[model samples]
Target chain A: MKLSREEVVHIAALARMSMSEAEIEKAREQLAVILENFEILKEVDTTNVPPTAQSINLQSVMREDIPGESLPAEKVLANAPDREGDLFKLRPVLE
Target chain B: MTDKYTDLTIHSAHELLKAKKLSSVELTRYYLDRIGKIDQAVRAVVTVTGDLALRQAEKADKLIAGGKDGPLTGVPVLIKDNMCIDGIRTTCSSKMLENFIPPYNATVVEKLNNAGAVIVGKANMDEFAMGSSTENSAFFTTHNPWDLSRVPGGSSGGSAAGVAACEAVYALGSDTGGSIRQPAGFCSVTGLKPTYGRVSRYGLVAFASSLDQIGPLTKDVLDSALVMNVISGQDPKDSTSVPETVPDFTKGLNGDLKGMKIGIPKEYFVEGMQPEVDAAVKEAIRKLEELGAKVEWGVSLPHTRHALAVYYIIAPSEASANLARYDGSKYGFSYQDTNNMWEGMEKTKQLGFGPEVKRRIMLGTYALSSGYYDAYYLKAQKVRTLIRREFNQAFEKYDALVTPTSPTIPFKIGEKADNPLQMYLSDICTLPVNIAGIPAISIPAGFAKNLPIGMQVIGKPFAEETIFKISYAYQQVTDWHKKTPKL
Candidate 1:
């Protein structure tokens, strides 16, 4: 259950977050404590239990096909920190 | 009139509205004035929608005058910022979304409005509902109205504090873990986390989808029931919303609970629990016994020790997936590029999300990644099932289970901030209900060292009516819910 510094770095990269060396060290220690505490699950017998993903046992409820009034383009873009004409602009992602 | 409205319960307010003694506009303005005067020091509301609320109040007043007054007509309600209110800024208390005004109303918001409730303002929360304390909010930490130096419990701290402070009649808060109940406990209010899928999650900015549920934080159990009646229903917009009939929640508030079997699990009285919290919970249990309910010490839920671990894994795993939609291009904050799309997402999310949020996303991504799903995510789900089965079996004999809502009383603001594991333990007793998808409520049980403590009443799935009945009965007998935090 021990989480290594490399594992923290790997998890951070997978999650698409940039972290500093200090954060990695802090995460490693914190994650280890959490993982160790989680080890108590090993004592429980879960052989016959079916995993419950949701509390309500209901299937998808779909709405009928219908058109509705949509917000104006300006209204939609009102909160954008950076935007172009009808589109949200962002920093380039490719190398 | 000011004091009358200030201390009035939702039931009393509804009566006043029907009798034409109080106009919705006046009630809304009263709250707005209160917020304007007191919130500068309390810091509960992130953004006050006074003008929009007045417009809604006018509409409610017209409805009341026209004899179409609903149960919640003229009731001014504060909503957590994470719940979407179309055209109102739904910041989730994060800098990235500080300016974001949702384009559409969340299903709950629409339902509340349709029920003739007026929106007071958006209350602050832990940024995207991440932390146990309001300190995580990027805007400002909402102070405990009772003790300004202490926190009011969090994620939904502002909602709980606002209701506690009488800034609003009732407030809606989403509980992912203990966000709703913990804050309610700290502020001495009634807060419920409905059965999963009971309330629509369409416009609630995703935190942990499976564990998240929107419910009410109110002054009393009756108001909680009334608010629950308005908000609980199926919606086609949310795929997971159940199509079951919304029960008349208030009808069963006076239902008899005599001879009901209440279970007290031994696991909840774990080591490290504050002596004050333990004493307060015991006192509440004794009161329940005095009300003619049969109490028994239950031995079920042996896997309770693993709840926090299981919750951390599963909640963060779902959170990672749910938060993936906020990549800056579609909504909220986006950084300007010197590179390409991948760099853009990295820069935006990196700069936008707080440290705790980033930590969870990373943990979740690892758990759900190709190789680790079985070991982490899938294993956690299996453990979750075991936990649910424990409750199911226990409920077959017990009418409801009782436990302390939190192990310790509300800690100082920065006490557990640096230690994530210590912070996670705050939800130990509360997380089982969320993981099991049962209806649970926290009511002010008593006080410890001048701070309020809460006792959690957990019931089987779809048993909110019974839970409320028990809670109402308890509130009627005890004055714990009436003990207000003096600001």
Candidate 2:
């Protein structure tokens, strides 16, 4: 049930988290214990059971396509860590 | 003991306000003073909106003067930090949003404001509501009001502690897995997780969309019901919030349980639970029977054993997706030292989240990864269906189910903090109710070893009134809830 170091780094990357060597090892050990416990679900007979993504039935929530008041540009940009004229300023997308 | 404003329940305060015996301003100031003096030890309150509360209290007084006051008018209430209030910092007890302020108020906040509730700032919580103990908070661990050395149970620990210490008249808490009820039990206060979709999630920060719910931690069940009446209803903002009618939750507190059916599922009283926890909940169930409930013991929910696995998988999967919004460019903490945007995003996520948060994200990513989807995520969902069905079938024969809110009394701060599985096991008794999307309430059943034990009363979906009825009747006959921590 032990998770390999490479597997831990792989999943952390997929989760958009950068981990140091120590963090990777700690996460690997902890996740191995947690994921090992997930083995319990295999005992349940879910042969014919359909997956339930939602407990209550869902329907398309429709709203009129009419224009309505929305948050002002200043308000939306207020929390931006770095912004340039109502747009979030991120570093170059490509190196 | 001195008679103080902090000791008043919402109902009693409402009466005083209506009769002009207690001014809203006076009441708000008294609570502010108490929190100012006491919250330092408990660490329950994160932000104290003394000015905003005073302003809101003044407005509420105006409404009362004009004969426009409702039950919650002028009531000082604390919100779990995850819920947004315009111009206030909504941290979710995470460093990612340490300075993040919301542009708008959450739907429940708006509802409370509309009902003239005085906003008393925010309460602490586990980081992103991830862990069972508030020790996961990046800021500081919220100490249990009853015993300062132990944890307050979380991620609603601060909310429960606030009410237990009489800091707020009542406080709002959010539950995904036993977050609200567990802490409520630990603090010896009343807590309720309304049916999923019963209350809107519009402005509340999302943790796990399907499992997360907004509820109240109050001094008593009647106060919880009073708050629910104001906050429960349909909201057009959150699509998941069902279009259902909200009942006057306080109307069912007639102390009547005659002919109502209650089920005691043996699966909940598991091995290794504290013997006193089992005994206290058993005594509460006997009280239910005495109140004329047709109590049926030895009931079985065979699929109950697998709930923890299903919940860990499903909740984290939803959380990984829900939390992807915090990439640092738009809002929340951002890491900008790197020239490459992707590197910046990754570093921001790495530094912003705590260890528990990172662990969940990793678990989620692995479960949804390409080759493993069907084995972990999909299989968990299928088992979720079985667990939900088991509860659905049990409800067909019973109006409610009774169980201990937590498996043991509140543990020391670091007892299970590092061991993730042991912390997860603490919530075993209360997890299935969330997986099934039903309503449940935890009330003060008794004290063991000088610590409080909570008995969970669970009801069918949208059957909060039945839950209130059962717990309220028990409260009538028992004096356990009447005993608050002498902080």
Candidate 3:
């Protein structure tokens, strides 16, 4: 259950977050205790259990295939942190 | 600035409004002014919608004048900050969404507006609904109304505190692993987490998607039902919202619990539970039996022990995926100083998210990572099926299950904040309900030293009416719901 500092950094990158050296140490300590708690689940026998899916026990719902009123581009971009006209301005993905 | 309308439930308020004894604007102002006067100390509200409330109230008065009003018409209510309010910022108590004003209303907001309920303001919560206390809110911690020193159990802390303080008639809260019920228990208000699909999730800021559901927090059980009547229904916008018949939640509330079978899950009453809370819950069970429900004690849901493990895994895994959208360029906060998008995204997340949120995302990333998936995420899902099956079997023999809503009464504000595991343990009693995706209601059962203890009434999937009926019946014989904090 204990994660190494490198492992914590890797997980942070996977989550699209960066951690300082201090945060990595903090995360390692907290996540180790939490992950160790996961050991309790190992005691439960689930030899033939099927995982619950996104579509739950309730009936699968489908709406009519038709167009409906939608938010305008301007409205949708109202909260954009970096915007140009209706488009969101962004840093280049490639340097 | 105090008025006669303070602490009025929706039912009484509706009666006065119907009799024209009070106008909607007056009632709205009463709440708005009260919130204005006392909210500084309570710290429950994130943003007070005084201007919008007045405008909505003015229109509601016209509806009442024309005799076209509904139960919730002109009733002022607070919404948990996670739910979208068009033009009003939906911060989710996270800096990431600190300035994010959704363009469209969440389905519940639309329903409330349609029912003529005046939006009073947004309530504070744990950032991204990640913690059991409002200490995690980037804005400020919402204090318990009963005692300013105690923590209001959270992520719906603000909503519960607001209702308990009479800041609003009722409020909406989203529950994922006890977010709604635990706080309701702490604050001595009634809160309900409906069947996962009973209420629409569209426009609600996603937490653990499968485990998350929006419900009501109110001064009484019936107020929860009144708000439920307005908010519950199938929405085409959210595919998970089920196509179930919406019942008039207020009807049959006074009906006796005769012949109804109630189960007491032994797993819920664990060691280390506060003596007062334990005694109060057991006493509440006796009260239910006195009301004619057959109580079956020692009913075992054996898989309950693994629920906390399963929840941490499943909830965070889903949240990790759900929260990936906060990339900074489109909406919400973005770190703009980076030369590259990758660094920009990373810096945005590192700076935008709070500790608990970051911890969850990392935990989820690790659980779902290639080598660990089977050992963590997949295994948790399989165990989730077992946990749910245990509830399914119990429901076959009982109409509902009764349990303590929280292990302890509201603790000191800084008591568990530093210890993450202890804070997480605050939700142990309430997590299994969200795991099983069933309906559960927490109502004030009793009190200890001026703080309230809540008892949870859990029901089968899509069985909101059954739980509501049981809760309302319990409320009839008890006056716990009648007690309010003398803040």
CA RMSD for every model?
2.1, 1.1, 1.2
lDDT of 2: 0.91
Q: Best lDDT goes to which candidate?
A: 2
lDDT of 1 at B133: 78
lDDT per residue as tens, model 3, B1-487: 5546666999999999999999989988899889988898999999999998999999999999998899999888999999998888889999999888889899999999989989999999999999887999999999998899999989999999999899999999999999999999999889999998889999899999999999999888788888888899889889888878998988868759998999999999988899999999999999988999999999999888888889899999999999999989889988988688888999999999999998899989999999999999999999888888889899999999999998999999899887888988889999999888899999999999989899999999888888989999888888998887776
Provide the lDDT at A55 for model 2: 71
Candidate 3: CAPRI quality band: medium
**Per-residue lDDT for B42-67 in model 1, tens only?**
79999999988999999999999999
Candidate lDDT (C-alpha), each: 0.85, 0.91, 0.90
Residue-by-residue lDDT tens digits, candidate 2, B1-487: 2337656889999999999998999999889988888888999988899999999999999999999999999999999999999999899999999998899999999999999999887999999998888999999999998999999999999999999888888999999999999999999999999999999999889999999999999888898899998899888788888889888888878998998999999999999999999999998899899999999999999888899999999989999999888899899999978788888889999999999888888888889999989999999999888888889999899999999999999999999988999999999988898999999999999999889999999999999999999999999999888787777
Instruction: Identify the candidate with maximal DockQ.
Output: 2
Least accurate 10 contiguous residues by lDDT in model 3 chain B: B1-10
What tens digits encode model 3's per-residue C-alpha lDDT throughout A44-86? 7778889874426556556578988888888888888877877
What stretches of model 2 exceed 4 Å from their correct place?
B1-3
Q: Best to worst by DockQ, what's the order?
A: 2, 3, 1
Candidate 3, after superposition: displacement of residue B215 in Å?
0.6
Error of 1 at B187 (Å): 1.0
Model 3 segments more than 4 A misplaced: A58-61, B1-3
Worst 10 residues of 1 chain A by lDDT: A86-95
TM (B chain), model 2: 0.99
